[model samples]
Target: MKLYDVIVAGATGMVGRKMIQVLEERKFPVGKLFPMASSHSVGKRVVFNGKEWTVQELNEENIKNSHAKIALFSAGASVSRHFAPICAKYDITVIDNSSAWRMDPSIPLVVPEVNREKIFSGSKIIANPNCSTIQMVVVLKPLHDKYKIKRVVVSTYQSVTGAGQKGHDQLMKEWNEEEIQEMKFPHQISFNAIPHIDEFLDNGYTKEEMKMINETKKIMGDNSIQVSPTCVRIPTIGGHCESVNIEFEKPFELSDVREILSKAPGVVVQDKPLEKIYPMPIWAHDKDEAFVGRIRRDETVKNGLNLWIVSDNIRKGAATNAVQIAEEFIKGK
Candidate 1:
């Protein structure tokens, strides 16, 4: 494979930092790396390919002038909205980690293992799904294909890190009994669960919750699949967990569901209820694969199932997913 010049946007953010780490850990072939960030972050250094690269302020001129072929953007939706098009016009494939273009009909929203075939080098922009949706879909895709998912109700236990480094700092400050700061999250995130995440819609559902509901349908490519989500910001630091109730179009046996997930790519079945070996955030931390366990039948409804899903929000949820999309683009898949 020929190495390509890549740009890491928002290099100072949590997910951006991990994107660089994953690039190095996966040994992604890169002719050069452009670490781009805001003006404040300009001149800062990020380690990549065993050496330090200085951060540059993101601008259309810089992106076009550098001739970067691929850019992994994690800055924010607004930043992506402004820069992704300019980069794409230069024939730069952008794998974005924000919610900016996920719903754009022209862009392919991808999770490599689930929908790698849907991706092509001709695709200029690819949206990585929300952290909650990414882990849920990894486990759901195989089952959806076999039994056909009819409806899904998911409640997420999301980590503080999902908000960013400021969220992490707030949690730490509150933990150490410092004066409370309420910037990253709306309310106190330490020893408290905030029912609200992102902005509230007219329907009373949060933006985060709706992302799960909407993104699930788009990524699964099944409009008939109904999804209702409740996203909560938990006190955890690494992984995000979900308690998912699923209703399948066809009856499924527990053993068969286990077998399918076990064989699915980027999925790890850790169900051993008797041994208490179910997946958890602490165990899922820093891991790339989605961890699934606590499997059992939801006997209240026919053809119903209950599962616990966990994955590192920073890894498989954001950085790794973005990099995987870029890899697919590079391979011309």
Candidate 2:
């Protein structure tokens, strides 16, 4: 077996740390792991594959010196915007978990289960879609293939972990009745829900919401499919859950819907209303598969179906997805 030298940018971040863990859990063929972060995080220790690795500073010189073949970036958009091109210039395939490159015409916004073929061996920069978008699209892809989706309405109850460790720390501090040292969110998150995820756009949709709307079209490979999303940050740590209502061009039976989703890749059907079982974040945390439940019909609209989707925001939504893209690249190679 051949191992590849892998660099994980933003190694100290929530998603970055999860990336390392996922790599180990999935037994990715990593020969040398270069965990790179900012200067302040330099020399920090991170455990990967049962071994502690010192974090390296992310700079032009460090990146150029590492000679890594693949770079998984969970750094901020600005960091990714600056460093991803450099990695590409070095012939390193970059799978980025940031909004900086998702909308770029050249960069492939990939959900391996949805459109793995979009990523070819020569593809340099691959963008991981927003956390909410990833779980939803994994469920949407198969249904759209059979029913031909027309539009989708999604309302997300996202976990604070999606915001990063600061968001998680803030929630813990507030729950402990401690002084609020820093605010990662606009308001208090304990027992509260904020209908805002990212910066509000001029059109009233947030950057997070728009990412879902547009990225859905791109990943599903359909411009005609419309998406209306309302992303909210709630006080939870398990995962992010979404209430997705989809309108299809053709009619479908509930049994067929259930069977199709059960057979879909990267999706798990947990819909059993009478038995009082459904998909929830508590069960989704740490899991890679997207869980779908609460399957029913939206009688008001023509050929409308409703679904509840849940998945760990950090795992499947960011780290696992990025790693899957890298897996696809290696398979093609």
Candidate 3:
């Protein structure tokens, strides 16, 4: 077995730290771990594979000298935009968690279960889809294959972690009734839900909502598939939950839908309405699989189905998904 040197950008941040943890949890063939971050976060220590690794500055000198084959980037879009090409220049495969390269026609917005084949050896930079989009597509792919999906309507009750550390801190501050200093959210997040995730666009839909709409089509490889999304940030530290209503082109039975999702990779069917069972963020936390429940026909629309999708945003949505893409690369080898 050959071990590979890996670089984790933004090592001190929430997603970056989780990337390190997932790499170890999955027991990736990692020989040397290079944890990189901004100047402020440098010298911070991250434990990987039970070893303490110091965070280094993400400068050209360090990136060029790291001798790493794969770089998992959870840094902001600005950082990814500036450094991802540099990693690609050094022949390092960059699986970016930011939206910097997701819409790029040349780059592949990847969800391994749906389109692992899009990735190839020469593919230098692969864009990991938005956390919300990743979980929804994982469940949608199997259903879309069985019955052609025409449109999708999704309302997300996302976790505070999706906004990074600041978001979590904001919720905690509100929960503790401390003095509110800086605002990560527009309003209080504790015991309240904000209908906004990212910046509001000219189209009245936020950047996060648009990401769901566009990303879903791209990952599913169907531009014709329509997606209407309203993303909300709720006070939760566990995971993200979505109320997904899917309309298929063909009629389908609930039994077949349940069977398809149960067998789908990275999907867990938790529907048991009679037993008072369904997916929830508390139960889905720290797990990689997308939990799907409340599987039933939407009586309002023809050929419609509704589902509740839940998954750990930090795990499957960010860290685990990026690691899975790296795993796909290793499998190709």
- RMSD in Å for all candidates: 1.1, 1.0, 0.9
- Per-residue lDDT over 1-333 for candidate 1, one digit per residue giving the tens place of the 0 to 100 score: 688899999999999999999999988899899999999999999998779999999998789877888899999999999999999999888899999999988888999988887677356888888999999999999999999999999999999999899889899998998876467888888889988889999999999999998888888888899999999999999799999999998998999999999999999999998998999989999989999999999999999999999999999999998888778767773
Q: How many clashing pairs does model 3 include?
A: 0
lDDT of 1 at 207: 93
State the C-alpha lDDT per candidate.
0.91, 0.93, 0.94
Q: Candidate 1: deviation at residue 254, Å?
A: 0.8
Give the per-residue lDDT digits (tens) of candidate 3, residues 118-169. Answer: 8783679999999999999999999999999999999999999999999999
Model 2 clashing residue pairs (backbone)? none
lDDT: worst 10-residue window of model 2: 115-124
Off by over 4 Å in 3: none
Candidate 3 lDDT at 293 equals 98
Each candidate structure's count of clashing pairs? 0, 0, 0
Measured against the true structure, the TM-scores of the candidates, in listed sequence, are: 0.98, 0.98, 0.98
Position 294, candidate 2: lDDT: 98
After aligning candidate 1 to the native by TM-score, how far in Å is the CA of 189 from where it should be?
1.5
**Shift in Å, residue 18, candidate 2:** 0.4
Clashing pairs in 3: none
